[model samples]
Each structure stands twice: as C-alpha cells, then as structure tokens.
Target: MITVVGTGTGAPLSPDAGAALAGAGLVVGGRRHLAAATTMPDTAERVVLGPLAPALDAIEQYLEKPADQGRVVVLASGDPGFFGIVRALAERFGADRLAVHPGVSSVATAFARLGLTWDDAVVVSAHGRALRTAVNVCRAHPKVAVLTGPGSGPAELGAALRSSGRVLVVASALGAGADSGTGSGASTGTGTGTAPDSGSASQSGERVERVTPAEAAARDWGPAVSVVLCLDESRVLSPVRTIAGPPPGPAQWALDEGEFTHRDSMITKFEVRALALARLGPRLGEHVWDIGAGSGSVAVECARLGAAVTAVEKTLDGVERVRANAAAHGVDVTAVHGAAPTVLSDLPDPDAVFIGGGGRELPAIVTACARRARRSVVVAMAALDRVPAVRDALVAAGLDCDGVLLQSSRLAPLPGDVTRLAATNPVFLLWGVRPPARDEGVAQ
Candidate 1:
C-alpha cells in the first residue's frame, strides 16, 4: 500500500508516518518535504514532485512490486485530503491502497497566528484557477481566505482589491527556520478579526505582514507566502453563528417596496424584483450592476444575495437613497452617481446586470451592459415603445433575448372593512443570456 503523510505545517511526523517512510521502497514529495524527513531509509527512491503525473507514475511502479519488495510513501503539505494530493492519488491508485496521515492545515495556522476565529470566513483557491473569482469573493464578503498559486499571489490579489477597502494579512514560510526556501505548496488566504499588528514574526520563522490593498499591490511577496487574509476592518468580527461560510445568504429576498426607503413610490415591485433576481442568479464570487438604480432596490437585493453590486444613478438624491437602502439592509454596494452607458465604462465587468430606468438612452445602456456582461442581463421597462429597441440592443450584443409582460394585482383594504384586488401597472421584463461557451471564455 502507498502511505500518504501530511507535513510542512510545523507539525512533527507521526510514528506511523515515520515508520512508513523508513520502510518505503519509493517516496514522493516536494523538495522541502523530502529534505525535512531525515528518517527515510537510504534505500528508498526519492521522486521530487514537480509535475504530478510523473510522481503518480513512479508511485504506481513501486506499487506493482511484490508484497515483500516494500511500500510507497507520499509526503504533502497540511492535510492531503483538503484540496491536496490525496484525491489525485486516490484517483490514480484506489483509496484502499493507501494509508493517509494528516497534519495542521496552513489555513488553521494562519488564523491561529492572528489570534482569531475563522469558522465564518469564506475560503477560495486561486491555484490554477481564474483570479477574478477570488477577487469577486473578496469584494462581496467581509472575510475571505485565498489559496494562492503562481500568478495569483498576494500582489495580484492586492492589485485587484486596491480600491476595495480591504486589509491583507500575508503569512509566509510557515513552520520553517528564519531563512527558509520557497515552494509551490498550498497558501491559505483569509480575513480575520482584531486589528493587525503588522510586521509580526513567529518563532517558527513564519512572517505575518499586514498591509493595505495598495501596499500589498506595491510589493512583491515572494513564493514563500503561505496564505493571505482579506478583511474589512469595520466588520471583522461578526456575531456568533451556528453555520459556517457566508452566513447562508439572505433567508428572504425580493423584499416588499415598503421595506426600502424610496421617494414617491419609485421602487421595483416585489413581483418584478423576484423574476429579475431569478434571471440574474446573484451569489458569492460574482459582480452585478444595477443601472439607473433610482431607489437602489435591485442593487441592495443583489448585494444581500451575496454579490458585489454597483448601483448607478443620475441624481444625487437617488445615489443617497441607494446608499441608504443598502445600509438599511446591512450590505455593501458601490453607489455611483452618474448616467448609465457612460458611468459603466469605469466599473468592473459584471456577471449579470439589471437595467432599471434608462429613458432615451435605454438602448445604449442595454448595449453597453450586454456587451460587457459575462453571463446575462435583465432590463425592466414601463414604456412599451422601449421594448423593441431593448430587445434589438440585446440581440446586437450576441445574447439570446427573452422577455415577459407582467401584470399583477394585490389585495388593498377598502373603507367598509373589506379588501379589494388593486391592479398594478404592467411592466416589461427582458433578459438576455450569453451562450455557455462564450461565458466560459470571458477573461474577467
């Protein structure tokens, strides 16, 4: 059987792992892990893991030997099962053929160094994945842990979050001497509670440096960086929770018009908002644009649904109303006071967009949003004349357009202790979706 041992998080090798290494016919691990393990017998063939497939092949070769020949052992950083090599090994050589030993994960070590609890933090990996997803997560959530890879390290992350008002805790060289070398192992990134002291070093040679997003972007934090914690200092410590991750999204969405502070009955009705939300599919690690956000109802709801939202309004009072509604709902939304089609140029690309009130510039706004939108775009219009132009704009941008004319009636109390069905105005809700293949190819 192949023995998988977790190491490199300042944890000593367990007796079983040590014995397995000593008796191994073949050993596979990173250079640091192999050098740190002094107990391995001289007869064991060492394969320094650079590319994964080659190492798996070597392990397979060793396994093919008879029972008396010897065993194979693989050393990895932290718990091999938690986004580690165990899955790869198990896929190549069946789980029953391996004995695994786990160690302290870098995420736990980084949070421990900060003297904070992480049961509420969102953890995402930028390892061999698009960095935009991690950036979006950092923008949407108050606390986040990012597992860094080559191109997705601290500098890249910081550059993306420079304007996001987040503090980054860069932890490097976990469980090593003061002069440790760097490797391409797992790096845990997250946001934590308590103000960072900055420039703190642990006895194990782990350097935990705290810097603002701008500062982090300015410097090159070498490959030794094990983890990064992105935090909003204002809301670092959340209330006690029963579940983990992102607080389980909002329990209720498509809030009533009365729930928001709007001027002169100028908010998206709950019925229309519900359908728009369904088409938008806002969630963690996504960005949404609410154009012509009069009362900012749609923007606030998108933020509440766990998406990074930017609300655009032409009037100053409308901008304030958007901000106020967002504050009232306890969510973050970037309220931009400017006309659509023009203001949207500066903002980041959105996964989905909701265009509320664009008058003469409705088609231009829809075209701008649909062209940049990675997934879909939803447009709500009260005037029937704008419907055809909006649909044409969506189609011009290579989107599959679909729409509905909604007419609803709600119960209204009458003077004689009775209720009457009050018919509301009709609205045209139009949405355009990009093809899946095109969405996957989007750079942002």
Candidate 2:
C-alpha cells in the first residue's frame, strides 16, 4: 500500500504519519522533504524526486513486492491533493491502493499568516506552467494566490503586474527546513509525530513580506518563496462571499451609459454594447482589448462578463475614467494610456477586440485588431463613411465580415405626460470572425 503524507507548511508530523514513515520500505519526496524527515528507517530506500515519473515508477516496482514486506510512503509539501502529487499517485496506483493524509496547504498557511480569510479568493498555480494565464487571473480578480515555481515566481509575476495596482504578499518558507529538526535523528517505531512544545519552526524565521508590484520586480525574492498572495487592498475584505472564488458574472451586462463616467456623450450606447458584447463572446480565461476606450464602457462590460480586459485610450483623462469605471463595477481592467495601432503591438494577443473610437485611423486599428484576435473583432462607428474601409480591413485579414446599423428611439414624456419617441443617433456596428480554413475554399 502507498501512503501519501502531506508535510504541512513546517508543522510537526502527526503520530500516524510518523509510524508510517518509520515502517516505510521506500520513501519518496523532494530533497528538502527527505532531509527534514527524522523518523524514516535507515533501511528505507530513498528516491529524491527530480522528475516525477521515475519516482512513480519506483513506487510501482516496490509495491509489486509481496504485500507482507512492502509499505511505500510518499512525502509531499502541503496538501498533496491540492495541485500536489496525490492526483498523480492516485491515477497510477488507483485510490483503493493508497491512503492520503492531508496537511494544511501552503495557501491556507499563507492566508492564516495574514489573518485573512480565503473563501473569496481565486487560487492559481504558476508552477511549471506558463505565467500568462496566472497573470491574467490576477488582472481579472481582486484577490488571488499564486503557487510559484522556478521561472514563474514572484519576480516574473510582479513584472507582469507592474501597473496593475496590486500588492504582493510574498511568504517564504513557512515551516523550518529539515536541517533544523532536533530529535535523535534516528528511526523509531513509536510513531509519535508530535512536534516540540517550543515550536521553533512554526514561530521563527518564517518570512512574510508585503510589497508593491514595482518593489517586488526590483529585487530577487530567492527560491525560498512558498507562495505569493496578490491582493487589491481596497477590495481585500469586500463583502463576504456566499459563493467562493470569483463571484458570478454580473447579473446583467450592456449597462447604461450613465452607469459609467464619460467625457461628454462619448460612450457606447446600451443597445450597441449588447450587440458588440454578443459578437465578442467574452468568457473566463480569454483576453479582450478595447481600443479608444473613451469612458471604457465596453471594456468594463467585457470584464463584467468574465474576460480579462485591457482598455487603450490616448488621453490621460480617458485612462483615469476607465480605471474609475472599472473600480466602480468591482472588476479589473488594465487601462493602457496610449493610442492603438502603435501600442497594440506590445500588448498580449487577444481572444477578441472591440474598437469603439479610432478617429481617422479606424481602419488601421481594425486591421491590427483582426490580425491579433483569435476569435472575433467588433467595431462601432458613428460616421457612415468609415464602414466600407473598416469592413475591407477585416476582409483583407481573412475574416468573415458582417454589420448592422443600430438606430434606437427612446420613449420621452411629452409636456402633457404623453410619451413620444425620441430618436437617438445611429451607429454602424461591424463585426468579423476568422473563417475556418476549410470554409475559405467555398467562399473563394
């Protein structure tokens, strides 16, 4: 039988775990975990996990030995089940062959150290994976915990979030290292895994440093960092969540223009926003760019629908307004203070884009957005003369183009209290989707 033991953030092992380690025929774990273990039998074969596959194979081989003599114990950091080695072991040996003893996860420990609750936070792991998605999650959520590894640690995360207005709480080595263990350092079968009353590991030398993104990026946090908590301090304790993680998408999107602060009347109308949002099809894990963000109505609405959104506006006032509007809605929108076409090249490729204002450069902006958008691009234009050029740009980019003129009239109360239709300005909404390669032949 394989027993997977979680070495909680520097906490002393429990008696049951100690006994299991004492009788283990083979112990598998990282170099640190093995070094910290005091009860492992001298006869126990040790496998340091440089790569997980070989260690798993060793466990399988040892388990094949007669049941009378084989007892394999695998040690892992924090809760093995939470983005840990337990899933792999369970998959290889099946759940029936293994028993899991979970310790407190590092995420739990980090939050405990901060004296904060995490039911409202989104937890993501950047360990051995691309940091882009984790970065995007931080941009979209107010509270997030990132599990760090090798290249995807705090420095990388901080550089990506430099202007995002987030604070990084870097917690390094919550529990004492293995070299600090003060037992006989000999294998004993008593299996009493209780920690010392002095609690040296739990109380001393554990570092939890809080820094802004700029501060975090300026220096090395070293490899000892266990986890980083990215928080927007303003929203850190925002109303307790009845549901955990990111709250559900706003009940209704395509919010009214008055809902956002804008310069003059330069904002997408609710009717146009509804259609543009439908075409954009924003969702979780996707990125959407809103060019010429004006009041950032489109960007704010896209974020409300669960997409990581960036708003590009040339004017400083527009950028501030976007930031204000996003904060008002309790959503994160990266407001880029620059014009499109030129600035768009540096931003991450998007799943979708919405061009609300581009002046005379509208067609060029549309071309750039179409080239980068993986899914769709939607453009709203008030000048009728710009529609053909915009459509041509999308078509030249190998996209299927479609559009509609949205003309709406609101019911206004007349002098005698009778209602009359008041016509609003007309807007041309043009949208494009990249046609499948197979459909190109038929279209041609």
Candidate 3:
C-alpha cells in the first residue's frame, strides 16, 4: 500500500509515520525532506523528486511487486491533501490502496505564527500558476493568504499591491531548520507561542516581518519565503462569519443608477448594465476591465459579482467617483486615473472588458480590448454615428459581433395626477465573443 505523510513545516514525523518510514522499501520526497529523514531505513530506495513523472513511475512499479513486500512512503510538506501531492497520488493509485497521515498545512503554520485566526481570510495558491488572480483577491478581501512559489512570491505580490493601502505579513521558511524532535519548526523571532519561526526576509535564515504594501514593494525579500499574508487592518476581524473565506456574491446586481455617485448623469443605467453584465459573465477568479469608467457603476457591479475589477477613467472627478462607488458597495476596484487606449497597455489582459465612454477613440479602445480579452467584450454607446465603427472593430478582431438597441420607459405622474410613460434615451449595446480557434482549412 502507498502511504502519504505530511511533514508539517519542520515538525518531526509522528510515531505511526516513523514506523511506516522504518518499514518502507521506497521513500520519495524533496531533497530537503530526504535530507532531514534520519530514521528512514538504510536499505530504503530513495527518489528525490524533481520532475514528478519518474517518482510516480517508481511507485507504480514497486506497487506491482509481490504482496506485502513493496511499502512505498511519500513525504510531502504540510498537509498533503491541501493543494498538495495527495490529489496526484490518489488519482494514480486508487484511494483504497493508500493511507494518508496529514500534518499542519503551511497556511495554518503561517497564521499560527502570526497569532491570527484565518476563518475569515481567503486562501489562494500561486504555486506554478498565475499571480494576477491572487493579486486581485488581495485587492478585494481584507485578509488573504497566498501560498508562494518561485516566480509568484512576495516581491512580485508586493509590487502589485503597492499603494493599495494593504499590509503584507510575509512569512518565510516556516520550520526550515528546527529539529523536528522538539515539535517546533524554526523560531520566528517573536516569542508569542509554540508556533514555529516562519523564515526571515533574507534568504539566509528564518524571519517574519509585517510591512505596508509600499514598504514591501521597496525591499528585497529573499527566495526562501513560504507564504505572504495580505491584510487590511481596518477589516482584520470582520463581522463573525457563519461561513468561511470570501462571502457569497451580492443577492442582486444591476442596481439602480441612484446607488452610485455620478456627475452629469454619467453612469450606465441599470437596464443596460444588466445586459452588459450578462454578456461579460463576471465571476470569481476572473479579471474584468471597465475602460472609460464614468461613475464606475459597471465596474462596481462586476466586483460585487465576485470578479476582480479595474476601472479606468481619465478625469480626476470620474476616478474619485469610481472609488467612492466601489467603497459604497464595500468591494475593491483598482481605479486608474488615466485615459484608456494609452493606459490599457500596462494593465494585465482581461477576461472581459466593458467600454462605457471613450469619446472619438471608441473604436481603438474596442480593438485593444477585444484583441486581449479571453472571453468577451461589451460596449455601450449613445451616439448613433459610432455604432458601425465599434461593430467593425470587434469583427476585425475575430470576434462574433452582436448588437441591440435598448429604450426603456418609466411611469411618471403628471400634474393632473394621471400617469404617463416617460421614455428614456435609446442606447445601442454591442458585444462580441471570440470564436474558438480552428485548425487550418476547417469548415466554419
């Protein structure tokens, strides 16, 4: 049977795990883990994991040996089941053929070192994956724990959060060199309790430091980092959560225009926003850009729907309005005080984009957004003259273009006490979705 053991930080193996290791014919782990395993049987075959395929092959081959002879033990960091190696092992060898011995996860150890409870915090992993979504989560949530990897570690995360008013509690190398016999990993300089030391900011040893986003962005944090906790002290202990992690999406969207603070009726109406949001399909773990955000109503609504949102507006007043709207709704939106088509170059490519106001540069903005959007782009225009050009821009970018005209009427009471239908100005809504890529010469 294959046994998976969690070596939690630097904690020593438990008695049962130790017995398992003693009887193991094959032991597989990282170089650090293998080096720390002094109790492993001298005759045990060792496999240092670099590329996982070879070790998986060894496990499969050894499992095929005579019954009761091949005892394979795999050592993993923290809890193996928590975004760890357990999933891979379970998929390969049936769950029935394996036993799991879990230790504390790195997230748990990091939080413990900080003396904080994380039920209200959102936990995301940047290990071998994109850091954009993690950065977005930090923007939207008050407390976030990011599991760091080689390229997406603290320095990268800190730079992204710069000037965002969030503080980063960087925990590095938790339990790096501490003797497992004492049941404590390395000591974080703070003597708060029994929690092990998360590593130092320097690559040489273990340490923990809490710094503002701007401060974190300016420093050089070594590569030995483990996890970084992004927090907004103002909301640290949020209203006691009945459920864990980020709260559920807002009960309803397409809120009325009166909900936001706008100047000169610059916000998109609820009627149009509903349709545009439907086409955009904002949801968790996705990024949406609202170019030419007037009151940022669309961006705020998207953020409320659980997508990471960036609102780009040129005017200083418009930028302030967007920030205010996002704050009123209690969601995070990165409001850029710059014009689109020029500012769009530095922002990460979006999953979806909504162009609400771009004046004469509408076509260029639509082209830029459509080319980079992974899913769809939606544009709202009041000027009839711009419709054909916007549609053509999306079409030329290889998107399937669609459009509709929306005209709504509200019942208003006249002076005579009779109701009349007051028609609102008509607007043309245009949207496009990139068609799936096809092989050469394939039929449409």
Candidate 4:
C-alpha cells in the first residue's frame, strides 16, 4: 500500500505514518519535506518531486514491487485531498491502493491564527489556476481564503483588489522556513504552530500579517506565503450559517420589476430578465456586467445568482437606485455612475454582460461588451432597428450571435375580479457566446 502523509503545516507524522515511512522502499516528496525527514530509513530510494507526472511515474514503478519488499510513501502539505497531490495519485493508482493522512489546511491554520471561524468563509485555490476566479470570489464574498502560488501570490491578488476595499491577511511560512519574522505592513504577528516547544522546527517561522489591498500590492512577499485571507472587515463575522460556501444562490432569481426602485416604470420585465439571466449564466467566482442599468434589475438578479456584478448607469439617480436595489436584495453590486461604452473601460472584463439600455449607442455598447466579455453577452432592446447593428458588432467580435423577439401577455385583473390578458410591450433579446476554443485562447 502507498502511504500518503500530510505534513508541513505544524503537524508531525503519526505513528502509522512513521511506521510506513520506516518501511517505505520509495519516498516521494518536495525538497524541504525530504530534508526534514530525519526518521526516513536510509535504505529507501528518494524521489524529489519536480514535475508531478514523473513523481507519479516513480511511485507506479515502485508499487510494482512485492509487498514484502517495501511500501511507498508520498509526503504532502496539509490535507492531501484538498487541492493537493492525492487526486493525482488516486487517478494514477486506484484510491483503494493508497492510504491518506491529513493535517490542518493552510486556510484553516491562517484563520485559526486570527481567532476567526472559517466554516462560513469561502476557500479558493490560486495555485496553478487563473487568479481571476479567486479575485472575483474575493470581490463578491465577505470572507475568502486564497491559497497562494508563484505568480498568483499576495502582490497579484492585492493589485486586483486594491480598489475593492478588502483587508488581506497574508500568512507566510505557516510551518517551517529559513526566517522566522513578521510579514511587512500593518498588524504583524509571529506565532508558533501546535508544537510542544517554541524551538520545534516543525512549528517555527509562521507569521501572519494584516494589510489593506493597497498595502499588499506594494510589496514583494517572497516565496513563503501559504494563504491570503481577503475580508471585508465590516462583514467579517457573519451570522451563524446552516450551510457554507456562498449561501446557496438565492432561493429564486428573475425577481419582479416592482422589487427594484426605478423611475417611470423603467425596468426589464420578468420574462426578458429570465431569458437574459439564462443566457448570461452567472455563478460564483465569475464577474458580470450590467450596462445601462436603469433599475439594476438585471444586475441585482445576477448578483443574487452569486456573481460579482457591476452596474453602469448614465444618471446619478439610476446609480443610486441600483445600489439601493442591491442592498434591498442583500447582495453585492458595484454601481458606477457613467454611460456605457465609456465607463465600461474602467471596469474589469466580465465573464458575461447584460445590456439593458443604450439608445442610439446600443451597437457601440454591444461591441464594447462583446469584445471584453469572456463567455457571453446578452442584450435586451425595445427598438427593433438596433438588432442588426448589434448582431453585426457581436459578429465583428468573433461571437456567435442569436436573437429572439419576445412578445408576452400577462394575466391582468379586470372588473368584477375577472382576469384579462394584458399584452406587454415586445422586447428583442439577443445573446452572443464565445466559442469554447476561442474562449480558451483568451487570458482568463
């Protein structure tokens, strides 16, 4: 059997792990892990993991030996099952053939050091993945723990969140390291892990630093960062939650037009909003844009569906209404007071976009949104003349364009409690989706 040990997070090997290590014929781990393994038998063949495939190959070769020859041991940090090497190993060698031992995750350790409970907090991994998903999650959620990697470390995360009003608690060298000092910035603390003594090598060099997004962006926090906690201090301590990870995408979406505050009854009808939302496909860890958001009905719905939404309005009153609507819905939405095509440049590119109003500038607005949208763009218009231009613009941006003219009639209360079919104004709903191959080519 291959014994997978989780260490490097202040937890020493258990008796079972030690016994397996002693009998290990092939030991696979990182350089630091191998160096710290004073108990590893000298007869064992060591494989320092560089690329994952080669280490997995070595393990496979060693597993072919007879059970009486020796067993295999793979050393990993924290919980091997949590975004670690266990998945890779299990894929190559069946899960039943291996034994996994877990330690406290870096996310858990970081939160523990701060006296914070993380059952309600969202945890995202930026290691070997796009930082945009982590950044977008941080932007939408109140508390999030980001596992840091080489290029997607604290500085990169901070740069993305500088204007997001988030406090970053960067935990560096959570277990053993060369230097045992505090991190740079405000509110620095040094503490040892759960070891018996202060000088224990396994628990030393753990430092936690709290800084603003701007502060975190300004420094080069060398290669020792374990996790970064992005928090909105105001909402750090959330009410006790029965469930975890983003509180389950609002019970219902496509909320009624009356739910939002708008002037002159100007709002996207529920039917159109429903189709727009379907085309947008907003979800957690993604960003969505609502351009010309008069009432922010679409934006609020997108936010309710668990996306980081930005609403751009030309009128100041419209912007205020958008913010108020988002507040009433208990979701986060950034309301920017400016016209579409122009203000969109200042905002980050979104995974999807919704255009509600633009008048004569509808084509230009659609062009801008289509070019920047990573996935899809949905446009709703009352004027039928704008459809051709918008389709042309989407086609110019290399998106597959499709549209439908929606004419719906709702049941209205007539005299004597009788119901009459009231015909609602027809709306043109158009959507453009980027091809999967093309979307993969873009920088996420």
Give stretches of model 1 more than 4 Å off.
178-204, 438-444
List clash counts for every candidate, in order. 10, 2, 8, 0
Q: Which stretches of candidate 3 lie over 4 Å from their true place?
A: 10-12, 178-185, 190-205, 213-223, 411-420, 438-444
Which structure among the candidates has the greatest lDDT?
A: 1
Q: Model 4 — which ten-residue stretch has the worst lDDT?
A: 178-187
RMSD of 4: 5.2
TM-score list, all predictions: 0.91, 0.84, 0.90, 0.91
Native-to-model Cα distance after best TM-score fit, residue 389 in candidate 4, in Å: 1.1
lDDT of 2: 0.84
Best-to-worst TM-score order? 1, 4, 3, 2
Worst 10 residues of 3 by lDDT: 190-199
lDDT of 3 by residue, 5-42 (tens): 88837667789888888888999998767777777888
**Candidate scoring better on TM-score of 1 and 2:** 1
Encode model 1's per-residue lDDT on 116-221: one tens digit a residue: 8888889888988999889998988888888888999888999888888889888877776411122223333333323232223332356667788877777766
What lDDT score goes with residue 8 in model 2? Answer: 39
